[model samples]
Target chain A: MRNKWTKVLMSAMSASLLLTGASSAAMAKAKAAPQPVVLKVLYMSQQGYSTAVLNKMGAEFHKEHPNVTIEFTYLPYPQLHSAILTSAAAPVAQYDVVLSDLIWTGEFAAKGYTVALNNYIRQYIKNPKGIPQSVWNGLSVGGKVMAMPFLANFQNFYYNKKMLAEAGFKSGPKTMAQWLHQMQVLKAKHIVQYPYEDSWLQAEGLVCDYVRTAGEFGNGNLFNAKGQPIMNQGAALKALEWMRMLYKDGLANPNSLAADEPTAANAFASGQAAFNTNWTFVTGIMNNKSESKIVGQGVVSGFPVAPGTNRATLSASISGFQGLAIAANTPASLKPWAWKWIQFATSPAVQAQHLHSEWPIWSSVATSPQEKHLNPWYKVYQQNLNAVYNRPAVSNYLTVSSIIQQYVHEAIGGTIPVKTAANDMVQQIESLPK
Target chain B: MTSMPVESPPKRATLRHRLFRTLSGEYFWLYLLLLPSLLILVAVILIPMLFAFQMSLGNTSIVVLGGRGTISNQWVGLQNYLSLLQNPSFWQALRETLYFWVVSIFIEVTVGIGMAVLMNQSFFGRRIFRVIVFIPWAIPTVVNAMLWGMIFDGDNFGALNDLLLQWHVIQSPIVWLNPSALFPQIPWLSNALSYLGSNLAMNSIIVGDEWKTLPIVAILVLAGLQTIPHEYYEAARVEGASAWRQFRQITLPLIAPVLTVVLILRTMQLMRAFTLIFTLEQFGLPVLSIQAYQQAFSFGSFGMGSAVSFLIGLIALVIAYFYIKRLYREEL
Candidate 1:
């Protein structure tokens, strides 16, 4: 009886050990698969500031994802246009990701180089609340989304608080006439320092600003509502005339024609100009003691409204989260990994942390009171984001923008008459392949 | 074979043995000396050249192919070439190129000779001036272009406008970049005499290029000056020759070869004058290289681009050939 009991007990013990081993194996199978990824990113950070923020983010990202390595490359602001296009065209996946000015989405997307993130967006981010819907508009074409917005950038008028006050105004001019009256008042009073200054050079920034303002005044689309050319209309010519008046009256700095985006920002912060139009990042840059002469002295507001228009037109530029696109040709195996990394990087928690360092595309991150409380600048940025107008998302957008810039520059310089410049745009756009 | 060569077992070895031995040695030595270099040259240059040539000839882009009018679908033969030939823009670019080259070369060659001659003379600051003259060349082309661009900026921020106003040369500032301003855009190379022409004048004006590129010519002239013995100068001076006379006679004659060398080099390189023109475009001067670049890279019309490129090469060769026939006739 003792030997029989001993054999039975031994069998029971062995069975228990074998059962434990089987259960452990099942648990291991249920655990998540380790997705190995090397995410390569290409972006431009303002030489010092953005780079610092990116480095900090990289460290955090690495800590969170020890298996995934990050490769980041920075380009100068001016060359971003050429660099992004060339990289996208090259055979090697020069960068697994890309960041650029907003206008590039149409060109990059149409080329089918950007990876479609629609499935990923629906799956990973069900309700990215704080980001603007306008951000999504730039990423989609013909029902397919080519990229995801990394951040928000909407145009705002940057005015010198002190200069405006001295010019007998407490805040920015609400309307175009009011602004022109202010310029005249300042000029007559000799309170004007740099004249009625705004950068209207032949570039996307100026063209967008002008187009938006014209749209504000009910000038049909700068390219017409049907996406056909109509820039030769009266409203556009009037706008051109108004700009010319600034130069003609010597109200604007003579160097205004050659100035690019940052140069305009520099001029405004230096108190060399009374008012200028710019975007949200100006707040962070101007607040720095070393860079600005008017720290805490500049105020952000909506751009001046056109006469007879109920609202001011708002335009978007890329200074923050640019749309993320994955190449169509990327391997199916890499697709899931790419989607996951994009989801993680653009997550609300991550975006909120990196807020204003890059423009946040997540509505939740952009509008979070928590975010506004920290930066304060996002309040103005978010307001502008609410009314943002993106450029026509078409493949030939780059060609179109170049044409506009050239014609605009010619008109402003008086080299080509305003009417002629406007007409030229119509002719050129019509001549281009539909 | 052994029996045929066995004539008292020749110390130097039979002809067959010698030929085989030499062939084997040559194989190792030749390959050892040239293999790596050949491999690298093929990898870097020859292959790329062949690829580019094939692309230029084919109907389709090797890299980015697709579309009804794509590289392959459209059997447009040299229709792309024919179109480029007829393009007004192409002609405009060619015209601008000629204007840029002729003006830049004229100023650079003349000023370079002057500087070289002066450097050859005894002076207090000769070394300093020579070094200073070389400074622009030492600086990158973009930097040099920037420096000159700064000088011509008609805007208040321009150093040139400031200087001119300070000297009371003008009461009001000029719009060197604007074609419409009363201070009309200066055509520095063609229409303007360098002084009246504004910064745009550099496209027409020699200053845009003359000072920037003069160093290359100066160095070449200096080499020629060195080769001409001091005896020639001594003889001219002994005859109580005027400075101008000596310059025309001994100096010009001996320096002609170096002058031709610099001239040939400049002609070859003149087709690719993008840095200065590209820089100036920021201020709004459209030159040929930039226009062509825009057509190709910006517009993505590889056929038109290749045609433009081929034309540029053709013109440069023609110019070079003319110079070669005139100056390098006997020696070459």
Candidate 2:
């Protein structure tokens, strides 16, 4: 009887200690459960204002989610493409999120470096702060978000208001006919050295502009509506010929041969050239006291339309963002944290803050009319952004770009005729990988 | 059969021989003295070369790969090389590169020699002219490229067109950058050559690169010129040998060795040329080095770019091989 009583006492004592330990373990679990994860994001930058986007995005993202850490690596424009390819596509991807052009989605997705973010994207929709539907989702190879549009950089026309008025136009040219007439008037008065310059350096930039103005002027889709290659068409020919005619008319500057974006920007900024076509970043440069000659007087224009095409003005993006994707092999534990980060980055709060500066703010929903005049011609940039259509979102876009740059550069340099260059580019694009 | 009157030093002969051997020895004090510079060269050049060679063997992504570095990557054996064969742009770039190499080296050499000859002569303000000539070469390549790019802009507002039009030779300024618009007038630099005829591509290249390296050639030829005694020239003059004849026979042959060395050096520099080509090529022309760069970085194909780089190095090697042969022949 004495032994049984002692045993019962011992069992009660053991049960009580076990209960205490379970309760303590539960308390620790509650404390340690969902610690925020740090993420590393990388993107390329041009020589100019593109870098400003990265900075603004970083600060704004951190503000919304202080628990998550973010890091950014920026490179020069010429080197940015190569740098991204060499690093992220490698076996050990150094970045969690990469900022790239929408065209690169095909290559990255095809190679399986980027993950489909569809599963986690569902979580973002339920959040109190809604994730704006990405503009670049349709560009992805799969229905998944392969890369998100980090910024919206599109080609915009920069014209001198004074020069346009002096050419006998009350305002900027509305149609291609008036644009050509204005060039003639400018040349006659010797009021402008080069009446207009679009930086046709044979990179993707010039090609996008040509297609935009041409598409507005044409009967149908260029290359093809479905991202196929077909440049030897009449629409494409007319676009090339128009620029040629501009050169022949003695209205365009002969010195445009030497001017790429910087020189052209400098020419327009120095008040030497009456009109210049560049991206959204030129406004920041024009606003600067040391670099710009045209401050408040610079007027931005959508690209001029062809004579019969009722298109008001056609604007296009040389390169723009696609949906961003996480790595497939990212630690499962880090997924929820990374999605939260993606959500934070795409939030309107972040977009509004980033767009307030000189960077190309990609979020259409977040751009404010009040914040439209951040630089000398911010309003014009705003106008261009609304109409900006990304370059062909295809897998083999880069290969096509390489071949096209060679032919386009040659054609622009006047070695090959429009018909020949067009035909060669078509052949080259056909030969390019799809 | 006896060694023909071999002259031996009477004193300090053993000491001198020992010193010479010690200086040349692998682990000697002199070798130790050269260790730092050798270490620096290896660190800066050789190691990177090895890394680059390894990278060429891999399927490295140039875009989204991050900032030009990733320590370890997956290897794609020979895919890059195969891709290059398929790439039409590669062949086009190669053709352009060859043209640039041939044209640039030709111009840089001929004008370089001419400049050297001028500098060797007695002239007022020659020092200033020599310095002024070197200014273009002394400037960094990035700046040089940007400067020339500004001049080549296709707009009628371009500096080159303005200068040409102001000269009143043409009715209107031409689009130098545009390949579509047929230029009414020939701007000497933009004209294409029909291979082998007096190529003017040589002259355009001389505009940028010749200034820096010509002085080097001039100074080298000047060194060789000093070795040709004035007595020979005076004697020739006394014997009624014309100045042209003297230059053709004595000066030309005697200085030929050094000129050969200079030519080899210039060819090496010009063959691997990139900066000016990279900057200006965007305006419409590309050199061999520029082609190599675009292949590797622009297309994100490491293997192909590496192959092109190696090809360029190979072209340089051919020149070096000829030089080696010449050196061996000279020694003989």
Candidate 3:
């Protein structure tokens, strides 16, 4: 009887242990599994570069989390901003992540379309210091970080090295006068059809170009401390005059007035023009063997200062940085995942891998040896970034940009005198409510 | 009363009998049949237009992206319209639009008539020719604009520039689409004329637009031509009347009504010309439609944009009314 009783007790203990172990295992599995989420990311279509990178990153993320799915919708660059704004304003959240333009930070934030990313960056990102202060400034509004800067873009002076060399200059011009002289020499020698080309199309691009030019000449400030327009000042007038002279003297491409950045880049890449003033991505585009006739013949330098001003006085070219932001309407359940995705995408390693296409935003990625090997133009881009200027960040930036574009375009086109155009731009911008 | 009650009381009309009489009445079924169309018209046209006018009377910058979803308005009677009227760009756009409307209609009608005359003829490959002519019309307006944008590209690769250069027609390439470049080419013109020289850009746009619209106008005129008895032409031939005379007298008078219809339609289309101008010139050569689009979408000034839209509609209505009145007068 004692033997039988001992056997029953042993059996009961063994069964209880098995039940405890199985229940624990099941609970752990359930805890480990993430809630199924589908994140829709809205970004500009850059011929599949953004889509490809995002897809690869998303797949890797999915492997670890196992339940999150990523969907991407790409729009043309011009349409993407409006699309994001429209989607964010919808009753239900349409996009979890939006690849936002740097200039839109203030407008998006003020309109309450994007959530402040300060907390997320602090908690999720390993090294928030990786992103440069300048880039961070570009993505901040009301002293709060609104986005994760993914791509750093600013204008760089790109010259045809072969043409410059042939023109008896070993490097790009340093001043406005020197640049004009070199262009004249280039035109006289029949080395190039046009000495310079610009993407001065009457769009936001024209606003960017105008701001950069005006800033370089006008003591690095296009606005007063009160945000009043100073583009009608003497220095700004000189900048406008210089642009007009280029058109009048036939130094710049006649089509430059109508050409956007892509068209201007094409003009330079095809070896039709000796110089191109454009963003850093043109380096990779012009260097690509399939796209360019001037492969290995293109070189970069800082944009020329006005004749009297030195490089130190000249402000940076207009910033065209693109960043990623979470929509304010994003469900609270998905905020953590969205923050995680942003952290992963803008991390140093991922940025380094896609440095050439997306121009690294993080200082660490830019300085890394691996990225240096990948993008030879990194140093030049970094130098240009140092001198970058940005358009006034305001809730009415789009309207203000349109007004600036109209006046500047009219000035360049000679539809109105430069003085009139400048005065009109100031009066119009000032007339807007504070 | 008791004696009168012996007679049958007059029967009162029943509701069913009245309903039957109404249904059987003349034009009742016709009105019933038209109910669906009237409802559709109200839904698609009248409601939106009325809403737009109401919105224009408010001082609302309700950008869907920039505002809460709620439709809130700050009532400011006629403020939007007054502001638009006072704006210089509005005046400039109005001037440019008038020029565009007049020039496009004239060119399209002239070219359209020529095409209709040709297509009206019997030929071996007439079907193939008709199809070819209609291809541009079949293309979406935006696609047509893009097509012409490439063709008129100011670069070395542009087909027009390449052909001109190859033929040694010019020493350098012409920036066909750049208004600024095209302006200086005519030095003899006055400053006002020089200012209007951007009309050359409009001319290029008109060419593309005409190519697309010419086919429809031609088909309409061709239909009118078919209606005219060939017997008239045969009789005129026997009478020794020249082809020009026949065209001037019989052909023209017969097609006048069709041409008038085309004129009114094309004028309205040109006044509301947005896609082609927006795609090609954008704000380069601002017009009423482009201005409305820029104000609405680009600037998010919905009230001002709606005001601009109604202005265009009013202008179109006035012009269309005059044309219809003239047609009536001609018929009388």
User: Each candidate's fnat, in order?
Assistant: 0.05, 0.41, 0.29
- At residue B65, what lDDT does model 2 achieve? 34
Candidate 3 docking DockQ: 0.28
Identify the runs in model 3 with alpha carbons over 4 angstroms from their true place: A1-35, A55-66, A218-220, A307-315, B1-44, B63-68, B181-190, B194-198, B330-332
Q: What tens-digit string does per-residue lDDT give for candidate 2 at B70-182? A: 34446987776677667665565565556655666676556666666688789999889867766765677788766755565554455776688788876665444333322
Model 1 CA deviation exceeding 4 Å by range: A1-36, A45-49, A81-92, A310-321, A356-359, A374-377, B1-43, B57-75, B124-129, B142-212, B279-283, B330-332
Model with the higher DockQ, candidate 1 or 3: 3
> Judged by lDDT, which candidate is best?
3
Q: Provide the lDDT at B63 for model 2.
A: 38
Backbone clashes, each candidate: 28, 54, 1
Q: After the best TM-score superposition of candidate 2, give how far the Cα of residue A82 lies from its true spot, in angstroms.
A: 0.7
The deviation in Å at residue A264 for candidate 2 is: 3.2
**Clashes by residue pair, model 3:** A316-A387
Computed on C-alpha atoms, the DockQ of candidate 2 is 0.21
lDDT for B101 in candidate 2 is: 57
What DockQ does each candidate score versus the true complex, computed on alpha carbons?
0.16, 0.21, 0.28
